[model samples]
Target chain A: MTTKRSITVTVNGQQHQTEVEPRMLLVHYLREVLDLTGTHIGCNTSQCGACVVMLNGEAIKSCTVLAVQADGGEVLTIEGLAPEGGLHPIQEGFWEKHGLQCGFCTPGMIMASYQLLKNNPHPTETEIRRGLEGNICRCTGYQNIVKAVQDASERMSTSAETPVPAGD
Target chain B: MSVPAAFDYHPATSVDEAIALLQQYGDEAKLLAGGHSLIPAMKLRLSQPEHLIDIGKISSLSYIREEQDHIVIGGLTTYVQIEQSDLLRKHFPLLPEATSMVGDQQVRNRGTIGGSIAHSDPAADLPGVVLALKAEIVVQGPQGKRTIPADDFFVDTFTTALAPDEILIEFRLPKATGSTGSAYDKLANKASHYAIAGCAAVITRGQDGSCSAASIAITGATVRTIRARAVENALVGKQLSETVIAEAVSHATDGEDMIVDIHGSEEYRRKMAAVVARRAIMRALERI
Candidate 1:
């Protein structure tokens, strides 16, 4: 048996120090060790984007990445998208646009979309489709999910020009 | 699913350190790059190495630069980098176009170019593109650094010319010359993430609007990406016309066994290869 290794990872802005088996995946580390279960494991294989998370500001499928691979990386989960009392524009767009039917793929879908918009804030419809292509939503037929990204893009653009009121 | 087996993890900071680890563990050690390919295989018990030499952290092997006669891309450069690189887009548009269509956003973020070539999966999109571009794979071993032409680098399905202790460090794509253009098209399987059939076409148009030189490669229709010599022979010195392009497409899969799987049948994939080859050639011709 191989010995576990001690590593430090920064997740959602908090430093997490732990000793884990060499084989532990980042998805398992987030769910089991840190108790951030928002990242679901739908396919365990990298095929399903259900385990997507932002490692060092880039969206990656956590299941394919070893926890040790993320030792010195900064990670962001769905829980970190919005800090207090409110949803991010993407989350709000999903709620308003009805982007989810089962909610299992929401965290990953949103995380992938988050990275997309972060990199290309104003993507065309075809570009948006390609951007979210990695993320799969078995429900809602992806029509509303595409609409949500459009809605979120508009909201994010509008918010950038005029900041949202602090308390509402 | 749990990983197949427990393995010792060694984080190598430099290429020398990685080589030493590989030499120490021998065939028992496997280099871990982005882990987009190996980890999934390990999870499915397709591969079970006793030691994982983690070379993903070696920062030196991650770069994309333009050289005098070629584009030097570090093997560890991720798909996301290729997709976003303005340097690659300006000189090698085919690379970014193909990289954008790879597994998906998250997969592109973690999958490295080096790992993809090293994996040498027949259905992989980049291998065909690299072969069409006539790229070279640079490897470092205990002996020294050597360059393997892309055609020679890919020997068979899921295999390369890399030895146990040899590490692929970079790929060198010959610079385009004289109204040159390239493109890649693939019919990807939604379930398996492998291309059902893919084609990459690179053409150089002469002053007379005729083909100066053309290189065509097809993947997923065979055990490995192979140069469509028949197509190239038909295309060279011919006018960039629909008739010639059609003839070239017919010869796209001349001497290969098409892969038949859940995604597509042998006949369908063969036909798709012809179609994709024609489209890629036309797209490349238009750019030229």
Candidate 2:
């Protein structure tokens, strides 16, 4: 007996209109309806950073946000980080370095790092570690992840990275 | 498995509409601000409100500025905003300091200060911080607006003085004058980051080099955020030496029930409470 509400969200620079049940979470909407399964739901609760996404220029756990709550808002997910045939600097950093052991937490880690590096272009190792406190990597032990973020910070600052184009 | 029960979603653009929705739905409704706390609880089926009145998008109710002699903060201001606000930083740096300790980067980006205090989780930092600063809580309902002092606002754990039909709209803090300094310290659970022991202290230094007015509050060690009056009484009208401050903070848990949970045992929290309170008070004095 769920009522569906009409909502529109711009995700990864593309706008789509849909109707969702009030109980639907933003993470569920992304994985199920939009077919953007890159945004993992590790804990399903807000404790895990696996569902982190950029909502209105700041990162937030999508699992805790209702689908209808994000109406008329813009969201950036892990898949939208780079265009076709190219890897974003963060993804490149992870690729160049062994940033993942299981890769379950990579997307979320990269998304969270995107916001962190955006706020502070050049962060120290301690700052990078503190930035990833919300994201838990049970297997990898975070040594390489910190290196990956540091690597991305250097690459991003090396040149003025272009903002992801909207709906290209 | 962590799905919330079906409910109606109402996005209120203004304060009046939010209050009106609260009156209309009564007990079956819950106010949604930032949705950081409410939705998490809902996912566990701990709370199943039939209507969710969302006030997170109210632009007019999201601000930080000086009004008259008071620093007025809108109810919808997020933790990240408060942590980055130059106004709050210049005047009340303790707020920003405590705000940074709330959650990780993502949580701080979305959790609102008003929502945190309204939830009044015994472990939350803002309740103790506001109590130390003596923030005036403003609420609105069908009967109109009234201000409640922070001491009377938090009734118990996960409860506040807000009526079913009332919505908290603002928090007003008096402009601190003279040699006033404040600080916050907390021992948080490494994984969850909830406070295991947290203390906030606001102190005013007198011209005589003695402590003038002082307030200290402790959280995560009690059933609710409580003003450590014993600690406050011991510090006032005295030179704040290390021994004097240490003796004062040793009473941080006097006549209080320390919460026993997975994070800590009763005795462990009792011990850590005094440690955090002492550190917070000492840091406040250094600033003064």
Maximum-DockQ candidate: 2
lDDT by residue for model 2 over A81-165, one digit each (tens)?
8887789999988887889988998899999999889889899999998888899898865998998888888898786765554
| Model 2: per-residue Cα lDDT at residue A23 | 94
Give candidate 2 regions above 4 Å deviation.
A160-168
lDDT for B228 in candidate 1 is 91
Best by lDDT: 2
lDDT, candidate 1, at A83 = 69
Question: Which pairs clash in model 1?
Answer: none
lDDT of 1 by residue, B1-288 (tens): 666588888999999999999999998989999998899988887898899999998889999998899999999999989999999888888899998888988899889999998998898889998999999999999998999998898888888899989999999998998999989888888765678888889999999988999999998887788899999999999997899899888888876877887778878877899999999999998787
**Model 2, B288: alpha-carbon shift in Å?**
1.0
> Which one is best on TM-score?
2
Docking class of 2: medium
Model 2 earns a TM-score of 0.98
